[model samples]
Target: MGAQVFRAFRNFNLENRAEREISKMKPSPAPRHPSTHSLLGEQLRHHPEIKGEIASKNDKLLALLKDVYVDSKDPVTPVQVKDAETRQEPKEFRLPVGHHFDMMDIKNIPKGKISIVEALTLLNNHKLYPETWTAKKIAQEYHLELNDVNSLLKYFVTFEVKIFPPEDKKAIQSK
Candidate 1:
């Protein structure tokens, strides 16, 4: 198309030949491509299954690459497939919240010196379920001195249980 004609087609005036050509063009029929308005307008048809074929080929290629990487894993880390399920942001669910443990184990402490697991549970419960695990309450329930309860709190920190009180957590978050 001539530059001036192209520019005129892009303009508002209907006096030009370009305008007449646009007016003469027939209205679009039902789209065979995207199904206009779920079966409405004129659409240039293209095979959509071609996209599925392309995706299958890409998956096959990725599998081949993963196999090669696995064959060389002696010197390389294994590749991980990540998706919304696999790569979720890690969440910390303070003590009373973790899903895996048995509450029965915590409640039924064996009849001896409190085991390390019991100690950990005792300390965790103190922070997690405060009404039931208050300093005086835990000491009274476990028949131990308040000093022993304090010692257990210090002891678990060595095993990576960083107990930040809610106030401390809030302060850290604000900073």
Candidate 2:
């Protein structure tokens, strides 16, 4: 009788072990295709405005393509010829407006009592949740006066960091 009891307990333990192993073997989800439409679908679920904007942009592109390819009888311009003769124009890359953060040297800032410049760097480097903080929020978090924050934000505008208001959920969703 004792031998039978021991065998039953051993079988139960084995079954539990097998069950645990099976639970650990979770299958990964199938990979989704990478496309602008797929990305837009994901983005648009949250930001309907962005979806409209993207639709408008697509319409414009289609119209432009129609004009160039369907309506025009002129010979196609070769990309190689264009590249060979095109002058290299210097276009400045500006940060978005109201963005006070600098990407470089942001990580060097100490956690508390960082310099204004360092604070800006941190803001640039970090992916910010706009809901919780705007440029004003960032300034407040760093213990900076409002005027100083505005001044710094203005400076960032010159660089074109693309700052938006905190309540702009569409911008966040699109990003």
Candidate 3:
């Protein structure tokens, strides 16, 4: 009877140990692979059409960045203000109201002729009465012949002026 009881107790202990080990074993994690769509479920929780929406949004973002960030190497010049009382109009050129000439002393012109730098300076400082000047208007204001203005524009191009290619064409055509 004692031997029978010892055998039964040993079997019971073995069964309990097996049950404990089975409970302790963790379930295998879900397989990770590109073909499996399970991992993307978390990211796509809010958006039903996430892939298509992401691609479209990416294209728009790229276009916006391109439009906002144009490539230009030229430095921008700050506008200067002059005292109204001290402003002098050039003898050869009529100063438009509220516009003053920069380096307008013709006597100091290096070659007795206005250089391209001088011409551009004059245009930059010229108080544009209408807020802008057409090429012909600029030529007339500076006492420059059409051809002379064209030559000056060409010189400015060589010196890396910030004018756009279309503006340059218009200036040349106006000559």
Local accuracy by lDDT, each model: 0.58, 0.61, 0.58
- Model 1 deviation from native, Cα RMSD in Å: 23.2
Question: Per-residue lDDT for 56-99 in model 3, tens only?
Answer: 65777788887895677765444333354457666442433223
State the lDDT of candidate 1 residue by residue for 1-175, as single tens digits. 6998988767756568577797796988765655454433222135566556656657687888888843343443345433434666654332322324464444344222455555667777866787877777766666567787767665654335565668645545544
Provide the lowest-lDDT 10-residue window in model 2.
91-100
TM-score of 3: 0.23
Task: Pick the lDDT winner.
Answer: 2
Measured by TM-score, how close is model 1 to the native structure?
0.25
* Number of the candidate with higher TM-score, 2 or 3: 3
Between prediction 2 and prediction 3, the one with superior lDDT is 2
Off by over 4 Å in 1: 1-112, 158-175
lDDT winner, 1 or 2: 2
